[model samples]
Target: AQSVTQPDIHITVSEGASLELRCNYSYGATPYLFWYVQSPGQGLQLLLKYFSGDTLVQGIKGFEAEFKRSQSSFNLRKPSVHWSDAAEYFCAVGAFNQAGTALIFGKGTTLSVSS
Candidate 1:
């Protein structure tokens, strides 16, 4: 079975400050990892993904993540956060099945940004 855990339920950041969110996963084999952002009442948008190769992957909105095989971790990082960056972030892992592939998500981490 595959599962993901996001330790932080919520985080608050000041504008122009850096931010980081933690994530850990349990999987039998290498998993497809992804980070998604969702605004209030909005659908999720892909921030980044780690399908294969390159431990470090970059995505839109100036977000980046490093896939650490040893730690089984893929943490999101931003050098500086903006007020508009306030949103809910979810860490997900993709699993393959007979039907197809599906994403299993974490509880999510809400980010509050203040100016």
Candidate 2:
């Protein structure tokens, strides 16, 4: 079974400050890792993904993540966070199966940005 764990249930960051989110996964094999963000009442957007090749993947909005196979972790980081960045962030891992593809997601970590 594959599972993703995000230990933080909530995080607060001041505007223009840095941010980092932790993620850990368990899978039989190396899985595709991804980070997605969702606003208060909107759909989820892909923050970044690591399929193969470079362990460090760059994403939009100055976000990046490095996949650590040894630790089975992929942590998301941002040099500076904007108020608009306030949202629920989810760490997920995907795998291809006979049925097709499935993504296992963490509960989520809600980000609160303050002035």
Which has the greatest TM-score? 1
* lDDT of the candidates, in the order given: 0.96, 0.94
Cα lDDT of model 2 by residue, 7-83, tens digit: 99999999999999999999988799999999988999999999899999999999999999999999999999999
lDDT of 1 by residue, 1-115 (tens): 8999999999999999999999999998889999999999999999999988999999999999999999999999999999999999999999765458789999999999988
Q: What is the TM-score of each candidate against the true structure?
A: 0.96, 0.95
Error of 2 at 12 (Å): 0.3
